[model samples]
Target: MHTQPAPTPTHCPYCALQCGMQLTPDAAGEGVAVTGRADFPVNRGALCGKGQSAAAVLSRGVRLTGPLVRDPGTGRLAPATWEAALDAIAGGLARTRALHGADACGVFGGGGLTNEKAYALGKFARIVLGTSQIDYNGRFCMSSAAAAGQRAFGLDRGLPFPLEDLPRTGCVILVGSNLAETMPPALRYLTELKANGGKLIVIDPRRTRTAEQADLHLAPRPGTDLALALGMLHLLVAEGRTDEAYIRERTRGWAEARAGVMAHWPEYVERVTGVPVPRLRAAVGLFADAETAMVLTARGPEQQSKGTDTVGAWINLALATGRPGTPLSGYGCLTGQGNGQGGREHGQKADQLPGYRKLTDPAARAHVAEVWGVDPAALPGPGRSAYELLDALGGEIRSLLLMGSNPVVSAPRAAHVEERLRSLDFLAVADVVLSETAELADVVLPVTQWAEETGTVTNLEGRVLLRRRAITAPPGVRSDLEVLHELTARLSPGLEKGFPVEPEEVFDELRRASAGGPADYAGISYERLAADGGEGVFWPCPATDGPGTPRLFLDRFATEDGRARFVPVAHRAAAEEPDAEYPVYLTTGRVVAQYQSGAQTRRVDELNKAAPGPFVELHPRLAARLGVVEGDEVAVVSRRGRAVAPARVVGTIRVDTVFMPFHWGGAGRVNAVTNPALDPVSRMPEFKVCAVRVERVG
Candidate 1:
């Protein structure tokens, strides 16, 4: 008698939505079958194509199964034993530190790493390599929103309120997020919001599929989102719709913010933003008239030179209307990566410690160092941000260790980043597959992936969910934790005790290190997560017996005065603008079919078949002017670099703007041309808008 085993419950490996799924062993025993888990409340039995096809990557030929070491004479990578690979990496890192000081060894991580891996990577850099040059790709994803949220509310959680509150809100002003394509399962929230008679306003340069469902779609010119938000605030004040009572009781610094908004009149803002005054008034009217409303932003406004101020402008709008802190009303950011929220919380960020503590704070240093059995003064201070670290890869930083990221295809001015990586004294990359960045590494380690390891990941809502191991990894592969453990043993003799190979052991240490900090996880445990039917627990879960906090700032903000701060900001031009040579605005983003860097998703057959390759999406008018039609090869040249792809002529985009999905590499790599102009506060690259010239390629 052959009785089938029960299905293993897990979450999808792709987006922040973290849709739940049930993985069952296949009949032939080749791989697992993925299906939506109806019991989980987040997705509720809905799964996107990416989620459905995630299992394909776990197949034999789809991913790396062995470690590889570069041959000095041949300049080629060849399969090698684990001992040889780890030894080479240890020697390289030690040699660099001995010759160029500890600061010369740089460590780069990604947003996809689990909480345990992120924490361990941070500890490895500070203790083993004794370097302060540690940062992750999450800096590019949510740092702008994070900086703005912290400045305004004194805390930064992706969504202070849960996604379940969307349908109950009276209106929602979605800024720059194409949820329909980015996370399909989340699109249901907007659909339910509309079904509940709530008005929806979408602000984007293109009338995307998500915008098509909006009651009003305001197509603002790129880099002008700041002006658009300020104009809305101006109209809210002019129409006498301001919630003076709420502002007086729950917020501060309104006078300066109001003065700033007043200077940008509706008619004046129209010229700056390319949105009409009537539409601005309509957006204001719909929002103010509603009993409860919410403002949610994505990468659109957060990936600019003024990203922090841009997000702050939107926050001012919410505060003026008395939206935040009220039921079903607030300002939130839609984080894109799988573990974007948790990745920043657990010390992977450049200036943060575990639990989102400031690295420069003496108390934070003492607490974390005590957990690791090290002196507080021995801990290093803050380092450079993501772009800055990449820029200094071969110069100030001589050797590098990278994990879970493919910066060669994802970073701004990627060609320059690639050149920097090539010039490094020695580079080691640990990834699930042979990513573009891995191709240039001196040593490559095959690590266990989502389904092959157990760890916790905090979603966009700050919910800490556990992803249980469902299958055995390949023979030659090892988990990232194991790799760190082996390397730590090689670098420092006695410090190996701090680097645990088991995920649960590493998590237990993380919990202690994070105790009493901003993103406390001391109360959370694998037992609790599993006992709760894998629904996951939210953060600020301080006490063992206490209920976790699902919503924040109900009665008071996290600031010292228990009130949100209103930052006064005004509109500004992008780093580069249209001129005689570069007459078009180029904006880059993701498509539904492919995820960031296309490291894992591109390997999936179904995803590749759907996306195929990159294409330059231009307005019909722009395409006509360039004498190019749909599928015609077009070259987009920017000040930084140039990229060529087939044309996608559509009427949805603005005539002066062109769009490109940053997934592929080689000639179609859009990031090769993206400007590295950073936001003053967040250090996020200006990926949303840059000046370029479009021409037809023969």
Candidate 2:
């Protein structure tokens, strides 16, 4: 009889929850099976619908098996050998650099990439391509929160405290995050909080599933979160609920922030935010009466043109309440993508280097250059952000290389971005499946998926966990590291010495490259992660034998003066407001069944059955005005483009706004109508709010 292989421990591929899971071979020995790991603290043996059915996406039949290149004669994609594809890409990039200079070569990365891949990609662009036009999809996900967090505390981590502290807190105010639909496994924390006699306050434009469970739900108008926060602060001041001692001891710049909030009285704020004064006052009372309170934000407030300032307002509220730096109380951003926290920390962003170091700093440049064995002066300066780089594609950036991201379905103003991709001189994409963006590439390389690869990813709580390889990839498929190594050899032969194909080797080098920086992951190793029994290790772990930090800012903030800074901010409308021609506000979000862009999850039959496609969610009054019944086709037209989906009339949403999930492609792609106006500080495109006109379609 043949012996069976031992089960391999890993984590889910979807969301930042990174719920622990164990993979074991099926009885028929064809593919693997997923089982929840009880040892993990984040999910605690609970798996959502997406996590339970994740193994379905690992089937060989639905995945790409070989490299494909566009046929010149037929103008169609056809299978090609690895040698031919790599040579073609190398020649294309070389020609672009030779004609338009090295700045014309753009590299776009994804938030789903492992820590090793993110580090290697950033180094590869600076050393081999010698270009600074490198950024990732995480810019669209959490750039605003990152900027605000860094400004307030002098450091940025998705969550400074662990999820295990949620139940112990006295109260939690969830701002604009629909955790029930976006991350179902994480919803248990709210349930447990209520079970522990903690109060829950949910703020959203619609009465979502997450909002339904709240003790008090405040439905503010779209893009008015800043005004709501300012109003709450004003009420706290009027009621004498502010923590004067904590403000004087642990925070700075509160006087200016206080004056800013006083300008917007409760009555004026009620007009701007469409939320009654009673509700606003009630929210403040619930939050202020608790011994320890917490505030958590997500994409809703972070995907706006004034996102950085908007998040700053929320942070000011938390600081005034004396929540941050206290046990079981603080402010945290609920990051969306799988590795969003780690992806931003270790470079792959336009203005950052490994270890969350600024690219413009000479010390950062010298430190990273020494690790890569290159001169600091040879490194290029910062370039355009994600949307800007995509917009510059046929013009300044002539050649492009993309990995993991499916921007055609996920980008703001996506139809125009697709046109930009088509105009590029040459485009190369590496992915496990032929995504909507990959379908437009001149060359497409098949790569190994999550279960077939070994790497590390950081969760929302700053815990760095290892994802162990379970099964071998197909014969023709290759890992991303191998693809990068081969491409480096073909493009710059001698420079390939430092590029390692093994994940372990690349991670070891990454540790050396990240020493002494703000993130400080120098002490984490694969052996240590595995020996932790799936609990994973947190960051700022500088010593090899010391316990990692699960909580931060206990004694003092990371700022130079050891106090959090409060930035005075005012409210502003969205970039595009509803007018006579476009009388309705449009907002986009995610669903529990389908992940971003629906690249891998759409291929799973179970997920497809649960969430078949997109639909317009609107109030019954608005549906009646448009003369559209349930399941009737409707067209939502913006200045940029139009998206058509079936209508679902409900009482949950506000009358002036409509909601749609931006997961599907083609006519159902909601991103085609999203605004591309970027925040000046964070450079994140405004995706949560845009003006559009609705019409009934036969």
Candidate 3:
């Protein structure tokens, strides 16, 4: 190995907070001891357990190399040469296609992919596979927010305003997001700026670590966040705090929204949400009094049965106050995944094409089709969503292609997902390591890790940051771009030239693909990216001579008729409500120690040591009633499945609700018993609130 390089600072590849890290290089020039850096917008460079120990994930402990093939007889994965592996995969896939048709094959990806990688995945799925059943994990993270933003305004990312925008806000409402654990860096912005008579309102079922920082923590009844939001809007309208001028000039559906809020006032809200009328009214008044206001939400709010409606209500809050398009004043969705925005922009979703263009939009399709050198009319899509494609596994979908996602562990209804995956005639998973989902694959392609790969990730605040290569991939591991290129070459002839050999060259293709598109990523060339240096280049960077947009809604909005429409949202309870048999509301989320499904973090011993295994948090009253003490192993069952995990008795949750982290997979997988019911509009699973019964086991 070469001599070690000096230690340098980097950024976390997991969450969108993009927390900066200081990496101490080993003598071999590999990343070691990743620590928080000195200066950054997110953490000022502080890292929780996940960020601090991120380097351990890239260690040799659990990394997969070459192409892995599972032996049907032994049911164990064995290494196969790249050629043999590809031929086998190609033959099986070709056979499946001949028997079941193109509609029978599907692909699933996630927001963790870099922009270049996401664009490549989309192109590969459409041009090579010719299948419409392609979607990403965003179906679980950003669908509701995306739907709401499009319905009200025209675009979607997160936070309509930049993060520091919090400093200028008079009031900030955080709905369902656990900022302290999920995005501590974002919370740092709030905590540092939130003083001098500003209001911090938190809405959740549990009194989380974040709740402690809130000026008023409204513990709404499980699945009742929408009711509380509507009630607050009712009070805002009644108090005459809404901006009539802005509304009259920039809104379309105000009359209906006001009417709905009027019909369901504080009394109705209090009854449904269980948040007292006085507190609800006070929160509404605080928001109304603020000259600048922001409504921020995360996956907790977006991953529900009525998620889209709830997000629509948040949009109305900003539009009603006339704070939209202004710094520190607007509605924002705190995106969960690292490249969530990039994934959405690059046609990773089932219904979208490259360049933030819709599949149904003929011009958008023509633009990408021309760039890809394909017939625009030949593109088969407006594909099936994530849940629908997964549900179709055994029947129409005979082959499954999953890249950079562990849906078996991360998707709702873990048991069902695992079974569906097993039913596939062929499965190929591309990841840096052999994840839980990878273990189930017929062929697992060892892909490059964050440290070993070079690309870009769009942070939570709409800033695109470069992911410089710090180390080389292991002997056989290849970048996902490289793997995809090889796979598609075998399936699709004449398209080999499209997949460039270099990563930056691939990014150039993506840059051109998005020319004149909504997100306007066209002008962002590879040379500009290199010269732009390590800092972020905020998007809508449409011109090389023009400054990139750091904050949105600065000038009106990108809406129909040049006026933003106020989307009227009626309160709808979660898809599955608590009842006599499964009375307790079980909610799942991230922990400070691990990232999603423990695909990366669990590989890190230090992080896993801090948060070892699955633990269901229970309120003191419920734990006492259930006869389960702290550390007691218990069976948590829902309509979908069951999980046995240790119980940690705490007073953070309401007596009727239990909180569990979604990191664990084996037996304690939170998704094991979680609900998979989708929102009618967004098709996002109800991950926030599901009914379950807890039983203590010896």
Candidate 4:
């Protein structure tokens, strides 16, 4: 029943590979099939589980077909016409703006927004709502990495070189990143690195599949990553592995770095990190011995009390060893979401603008204002982060407009987010599917999914590839950009291009906006993309004449003095550690099959079966202590909330800790009981290392 088609160009929907796919759609038009194309720059003839099944997502049932409004009086949702829905939403927003000042209103968006959508949304928030309170979920994932990388190395990209270049690395130190389960496809790079005699070091509490391939796995106690990193840095310095030339001529903070590490050497670090001195010293040796190495950390390291410091400490590894700035030899944050890097690049983060420019910088504000055609002073500067944003609701926030994000279920302190949403004077949500947070919204706007939209997403490698539309959006759903245009026309500052009907035109605006910023796209034109077809190109790519810097900092860096500074770091304990009442440390992460919260992934038949529900993974000895058996429901309690789930006894985890996936809610909102403590440097709320007690839910 299968018939293949002639060569055609396409894009993959997973893990930022942006692999070129030759899609063979049934001529009669039933379903689409994908095969890896040979010429793809990131991946050649290789598609991961998520990419191979991308077509299946289009056929998945339960897409939001029509606009629906929850009747004010009846309090029940009913299919409504677009006119009626739009009018209702506009009226409510107008009323809310009149009741509360514009500053009382805020908007949130997704990192997955296309360049055009990101540009338009930033314009709309500034010119229309005129509010400084705007941010997105990317705040929780990579803000710390972005902040630290910019300050330390001058630029931040998930992979400084092509992912295929990992094989050329001499060593790979994965600190607090579970790539095997989270992004299975990206893990291919690690395997290649290992095969070439490159040592692999994994620093995590649980023994994951990634750890299985590792040369050494350091199972430090929860929230002690900074301690371990400091200890490693101390070893590197004590043994004379410090790159004296790179430190002296290039770095400005060596004296401070050396002092910080010496202040907390082996003895203090071993006590806090729970790692033996010999093993710690050995791990440092491997990092220093490798001539070329790459260091990567993810949410696990950045989602803690000292998340930013953890990332800075990881950077300390590359600086001390003289490994950064070469191909596959830099410190990079493995960004999680599909468009996580691009999301924050375009003003969705609390204190940033499009092009990765900060809000507080006058030059950045002036540059963005010129693009936006507004006074620089009109654009608000820095504001509170995600956790603080949630807590500010109802108290300082009177209105909220959410696009493509589920704050209630996704944010830490779930109970608080839910309460804050209910307390809002007006709230609206735009999504293609009915979500837990959308159900509580005053107006729910329907939108298109990935396959139904035409746009571009910058992948982890900083490669920008076109996301081609294969099929029409289901029923009356509109693109997010389209809806916002119409909505803003009725308000002040007016919409640019007035209800832009074409996606190409929207992307055009983004290019102009990027004229002079960190993520410069002035050279990337729609015509060029059309000519290039399916080839993914990295950013800072000026034109065909200019070759994109495959790897950054070959000699100098993007810092104020052209030299990379070595930032010093100190270790801090987790906000919540094991206590008498809650003696077990609970860590939350994702399973391979399920995406965040299982919102869309759970509906996919294959993905759902692969990872059905949440489970509390525990060591055999720990399960025995609670008299809990495999497949038996057990109550896991923490300071904020509790949930009962099946026990999965495994020897992979330390006896003092348990692991669970954070993609479930209702009674399973892990963040409900998770520590809401903020990282001092990153301002990211802690999602890992929460103190909890597990008991059989008899």
Candidate 5:
């Protein structure tokens, strides 16, 4: 009789929850079967629809198996050898650099990449191509929350406390997050919170599944979250619920923040936001009355043009209530992508180095330079952000290397972005599938998928986890690390030390580079991570023998004076508001079955069946005004573009607002009409709110 090997424990590949799962060999020996991992603390054996269907994407039938190059004469992509593809990419990049200088070459990365891949990609861009134009899609995910968190606490780690603390907290004010749909398994924690006799206040424009579970749901007007938060602060002060002693001891700038909230009286805030005065009072009473409470924000408020200031308002509320730095109480951001927290920490961002160090800081540059064995002066400075880099594709950047992102379907003003991609002189894409963006590339290199690679990824709670390899990759597929190693060698032949293909070796170098920096990972190693029984370890572990820190800012903030800053922020209107031409508000979000961009989730039969296509969700009054029924097609026209989808007339949404999920392409692509106006500080696009006109189609 043949013996069966032990199942490998790993995490899901969908959202930041990173729900634990086990992969066992299939009976046919071609793929692996997935099951819930009960011992892991995050999810505790709960698996969502996306997690259960994740293994379906690992089949060879759905993934790209070899390299492809576009024919010069035919303009059609054809299979090619790996050597030929790499040589073509190297030649194109070199030619572009010789013609237009190093700044002409750009590198674009993704939020889902492992820490090893993100580090290698950033290093390759700065070292091999000698280009300063490097950034990733994570800029659009949680940059506003990160910028606000850093300013308020002197550190940003998505979540300051673990998920286990949620149930113990007396009250939780969840703003703009739809965890029931975006991350189903994570909703269990909120459920348990209610079960423990705790109260939940959910704030969103639409009555979503998450809001349905809340004890009090505040459906405020779109683009009015800032006003709602400021009003709550005003009510807190009126009721004398402010933690004066805690604020005096642990915080600074209280006078300025207090003065800012005075301008936003309850009546004035009620006019700007559609929420009633009584509901606002109830929300504040519930939050302020609890001994220990928390505030969490997600993409809804963080994807606006004034996202930085908007998030700052919420942070100010937390600070005034003395939530942060207290046990089981603080402000946190619900990161979207799988590695959104780690991807930004380990470089690949326009203005950061490994360990979340700023690129323009001289000491940071010198510290990282010593690890790479290069001079500090040789490294390039910061560059344009994600949207700015995409807008400058044809003019300043002639060539681009994209990895792990499908920007054509994800970026705001996607039609314009697609035209920019068409105008590029050369384009190379590295991905496991022939994504919509990869189809436009001159060269496409096939890479290994999640189950076929071994690497470390940091989750939303700042826990660094090891995803072990459960199966061998097919013949023509290579890991992103291997691709980067070969490309670095071919681009710079005379370098003494070459890029490492092994994930452990790359992680060791990453530890050395990240030591003494803000998001320090010096103490973590492959052995330490594995010994934790696949539960993973949190970051900021400075010593080799020390256990990682699961909660941060408990003793003191990371500020120079060891005090949190209270930034005074005022409410502002969205970049584009409803006007004569566009009479209604438009918002975009996700569904329960499909993930971002639908590049991988759409390929799975079960997921596709669950969410076959996109639809416009509107109030019954709006549908009746447009003379549309539940199944009738509706045309939503924005200033930038237009999209057509079937109508779903539901009373759960606001009458003046229309909703669409941004996961499909073609006529159903919602991002085509999204506003591209960026936040001055975080550079986040206004994806959550825009102006549009809806009409019934025959």
Candidate 6:
């Protein structure tokens, strides 16, 4: 009798949606085919173009199948055995540490790494290398939102309520997010909200496709989202629509927040934001009138020099409206990277310990140190944020171990980051492909990707999911767990006790380490996750017999007084403003067909054919001012650098602002001209708004 095995279920590799999918192996036994899984709640039977074509990267020809070590004789990368590659990496790291102290060695991680990998990488950097120079690419993704959430609510989860609540809400204010393009599957939530007779309001500098579906769209100047929010707050108060009872009972510090908004009158905000007062009043009416409403923000508002304060302003508005901690209403950030919520929770971030614990806190240090079998005093303190760490390379930091991120193509002031990377004395990178960053590495280790590995990832909704190993990895490749285990064994020698090669074993330790921290995952396990027909469990699952929490802050917040705090914030100009030298605002975002850095998605033939390459999206007015027509080569010049791409003139964007998708690399890379100004609290760069001048290229 001939029998066939059942297809393995997993999650998508791109974006924070983490859409559920099933991989069925080909009968010829070569590659697997991906299909949307109808059972998962997040994206029930729905997959984006990137999700449906994810399996294409799993082919042996598309990904790196072996390790490569730089040859000193020829100054080129050459194939090498795993043993040799690992040995070379160990030698490089050891040499750097011995010659320049442990602080000279650094570890850079990514948001795409699974929960297990993120945990292991953080542990390796602290315990094995004993360096405080560890951070992940996620610092650039949601650090501002995370900082604002923690400051206001004392806990940071992407969404306090799940995605299922969206359709039930009375109204939703979609701020600075293009869900229709970034996460196509999530756009249905807005459609469903409208179908249920709920109003949708979108705030952006561009009239994006997502904005077109909104009942009202407010087009503001780049970097003025804070002012727009303040204007709305001012209107809410002047109209006497503030939820006084809810504000008094459920929150604190409202008086200060109220006073701050009063100064920025609607007329004043109109001048700052270029959004009319009437439209602002209309937005305030829709929000205050709704029985249950929500505010959702994405990269647009959070990728600025004032990102933390900008996000805090939004939280203040939500608090004033009594929206959060209620059924079907709250403030949430649409986390961008896959596992972004989980990646930060587990401790790949610069300033935190496992389970989102403060690294400087004695209790946090003592608790996590006990789980890792280390002295509390032995663990390193907080390190620099992502951009700062990258900037310090070759100066204070000499060697770097980069995993899963292509920062050369993604970082703000990317050209400077590439220069810093080139300056590093020793660099090692582990990724599925030869990314732009990997091309400059001393050693490149090929690692198994999503479908080839079994691990856990936390989605935007705080739902912890298990991505099962659906297919065999290409020969000569290794899982990140295996790579971490081997490297730890080499670096620490006799002290390689905690590092485990199996994902489940590491996850068990992670649970214990996260037992009592803010983002606790103690109750979660592979068994519990695999149970319930693989629906996955939410976090704050503290006990083995208990059910995880789906909605948060229903009764009280995570604050000391059990009430959310209102952080007083005021609007400010961006780090850079348009002037005579750079007379236009430059805003960057994602295109529907391409994902971040274009590391993996660009390899897909279908995606490439659809997007082809990067282009400068300008308002028709700006195109004419530059004397350029559609498809004409144009150069966007900023103080940092310049990028040349074909012009894409359209009426969808504001006349004062120009837009570019930050996906492609090389001459078309927009990040090359982005500002690296750090937010005071969150240390996030001004990736969304910069000042630039456009000229037609000859």
Per-model TM values vs. the true structure: 0.99, 0.99, 0.97, 0.96, 0.99, 0.99
Error of 1 at 174 (Å): 0.6
Per-residue lDDT over 201-282 for candidate 1, one digit per residue giving the tens place of the 0 to 100 score: 9999999999999999999999999999999999888889999999999999999999999988999999998999999999
Taking the tens digit of each residue's C-alpha lDDT, what string does model 2 give over 657-696?
9999999899988999999999999999999999999999
- Model 6's C-alpha root-mean-square deviation from the true structure amounts to 0.9
Candidate 6: residue 177 lDDT (0-100): 97
Q: What do the candidate models score in CA lDDT, each in turn?
A: 0.94, 0.93, 0.82, 0.78, 0.92, 0.93
* Residue-by-residue lDDT tens digits, candidate 3, 263-338: 7788888888888999998788778878777888877778888888888887887788887876668888888888
The C-alpha local distance difference test score for the whole of candidate 2 amounts to 0.93
What value does the lDDT take at residue 552 in candidate 4? 72
Better of 1 and 6 by lDDT: 1
Model 6 agreement with the true structure over 188-262: per-residue lDDT tens digits = 999999999999999999999999999999999999999999989999999899999999899999998899999
Q: Pairs clashing in candidate 2?
A: none
Off by over 4 Å in 2: none
Report the C-alpha displacement of residue 556, candidate 3, in angstroms. Answer: 1.6
lDDT of 5 by residue, 257-354 (tens): 99989999999999999999999999998998899999999999999998988899999999998899889999999999999999999889999999
Error of 5 at 71 (Å): 0.7
- What TM-score does model 4 achieve against the real structure? 0.96
